[model samples]
Target chain A: MHSLTRSFLAVALLASVSAAHAHRTWLLPSAAQVDGKDPWVTVDAAVSEDLFELGANALKLDGLSITDPDGGSVQPNQTSTGKYRSSLDLKLAKSGTYRISLVSETAMASYKLNGEMKRWRGNVADLKKEVPAEAEELSVSTTLGRLETFVTAGKPNGTALKPVGSGLELIPLDHPSEFLAGQPARFRLLLDGKPLPGLTVAVVPGGVKYRGVLKETALTTDAKGEFTVNWPTPQMYWINAGYPARVNVPEGQPRPPMPAKRYNYSGTFEVLPQ
Target chain B: MQKRKLLLTAVLASALPALAAELSVKIDIPQLAVAEYHRPYIAMWLEKADGGQVTQLAVWYDQKKKDNGGTKWLKDMRQWWRKGGRDLEVPLDAVTSATRAPGLHALNFAAGKAPLGQLAAGEYTLFVEASREAGGREVVRVPLSWPPKEARSTGSKGQEELGNVTVQLKP
Candidate 1:
């Protein structure tokens, strides 16, 4: 009887301690803010699975809430990866204000994309950091569907750049002589000064082949006009688009044979692993 | 040992498609990166001089990365992307290694199989693109005459970052 009573007390004490520790480590779920017009931030949500810091956000996002300054909210769930996540149907389409914030009752730390929280003086509740604006933002279109909203930006009256009719852009990287597989090459672009949106671009080696094999992640173009497509193995291809032909005919012209331009931009390279 | 034999048998089976009438080709690139650093993924493919997809051979990338980040670099690899970036998913093991640096890389086309050299007769362009991590990008093209994949191996280059690239190709 005496041991039973002591065990009960121990259980109650342990539960309380656990609750306290969880509360102490609690942080506000973080959200990135994109302010242009139809401000929609792409949530990479790459949660680090193992953070060595004792009080780090252990990558579990069960109790997180995303709130926009314009009175909008969303709950991002984890995808196949431990790091990546996406919010469901939340749109920040307001004109006057734009900000997406996340705070975890658990950790109390908030993350805003492109925000540098260095030299913060007081508490995080009123922390103010300026998020840099994306110059030329473009919406994405995949076999899945078009990005939820149109990409918008700051500039007072700049007309919006329409999405590529087929949601595609022709990217060209130039180099002198042929590129040997292991040797590095270089080139510039005709649209260097133009404001271009982020899109999936590819390298088509041969001037003739359509629907050639692709190198993964290598298809995406970063903010910089730079792109990288790893060779699946060493091979050959041509230049073209990633999407199916969706453009309409002008009442008379036949469908262009997938726009394979010889445009003096052709070559070969060996693809041996490093 | 049985697995090795099976793999060998599979390679032989795949090679059966190459029992063609003529032609032979190969590429050589030494000094590649195989560590935990950033090396650009490269792609090579064939097309008629008029610019159309013919065949896709290889893509080098790390499958473990996110958001198609590994394949995202294909844009700079202009030629291959045009023909089939959207369609091909080169199996991870085919391109996986530690990491890659710069130097020589080579692919060979043997006799009686994919007679790459014996093209009946016409103009063709072989293209390549490099999408590096820390540096800039580049694409090179070699203009070849018909029948023989051996044509002085002419090529065009890009800008300041990717060092001088030279394609020493033959028939």
Candidate 2:
């Protein structure tokens, strides 16, 4: 009976790991481009098993940041969280691009404690305080993720598109707001302020509930870490890229040991009709 | 001294071309038999051979709307908006005007002027885009060389939203 319970616990753990991979986190905006003065844009943040259909959980807003066109920070006018999604309304008084992003670093661990399997998710500092030192088969991983969307009030500018030089980021070679169907949009990928080349990026258009096929487009970056996407139709698109690396821990560190680090970047872009 | 300067200016003027180059544009707003129709917002601009915007010549919108409400729909002209229209502060006395009725409107621009004085002698394309409420959008282009060695006329036609668009260059 003991061996059978152990085997079942292992299967459950494997299923949970795959479930995490199936869920995608995203931010969807009401409008990508606004022409009038002092326009307002509402954004919905969520994580779901489908591309953009809110189903899994409401994404936490603890790391939310809004960068205006002039590189100044702005606060959301209103914010709310429901069971499936978190949303915010932002007033775009500025005349250029605004970047709404949620950046977070989380440490997650799965371990066996008292003959039972358990999982813990929180910041790095809480690992020791929450998970007992006597826990067996403890495996910890850290994830640094950024999910973002862009909106232009009057004209699209590059001021807010500048990368923060940490984790994975997408640099637009062309204006993000100007993506059109049948036209190729170019972007570059950077990891920790350096080029991340030879990576496969996935582009999936939203409205999956109505379409019969997912029709996902996979693109690869070149030596310059640049990739081009020829949008098939006019709709909101979700693009994501991920990279994993083994963490190098210094000798005799007092903190809990994290074995690996994962970097994830995702963006929501709207492509207009030609 | 003033007389001498005038004499020098006259000599220089005589050395140059007798007639200043001028561009005359004729745009036709088509009358559609649709249930709901609004005067189309039009944007006319000059672009270089490589598709870079050179200058905005004209924009026709409903300037009488309350508190610049007409500017809200300017994004419907997506091509021009992406080119440079989004950056402009409308009600600009130079290039902005009220929407026109369904008819042909002729506008003349002098070469040595505020908007056109910066144009160099090269090949350029004129882009005219129009969008309407509850209607379709259309774009028409006319390619011509600046400071034409001789008079020339070029034009393009649209099936909807707009009619014939003509560009006449005078040397």
Q: Highest DockQ, which number? A: 1
Per-residue lDDT of B162 in model 1: 37
Model 1, docking class: incorrect
Models 1 onward score TM values of: 0.30, 0.55
Query: Which residue segments of model 1 deviate by more than 4 Å?
Result: A1-274, B1-37, B63-79, B92-99, B110-120, B133-135, B149-153, B169-171
The CA lDDT at B82 in model 2 is 93
For candidate 1, give the lDDT: 0.35
Give Cα-based local distance difference scores for all models.
Answer: 0.35, 0.81
- Tens-digit lDDT track of model 1 for B1-171: 999999999998666544432222232222222111245666655677665636554566655465655555455456566777666765533333232445544455433234243444567666655554422345556665544444244445544223334444333
Segments of candidate 2 deviating more than 4 angstroms: A1-15, A114-117, A123-125, A245-259, B1-171
> Tens digit of lDDT per residue, candidate 1, span A22-63?
211111112222355454433322221111112223323332
DockQ of each: 0.02, 0.01
Q: Residues A1-274, candidate 2: write the lDDT tens digits.
A: 7555545544444344434654678999998998875699999999975567777799989899999999999999999999999999998888999999999887777778997889887877788999999999776777888999999998789999998899999988889988999999999999998888988888878875454234567688999999999999999999888774222223333322333687888899999999
Report how large a share of the reference interface contacts model 1 reproduces: 0.00
TM-score of the second chain for every model: 0.56, 0.87
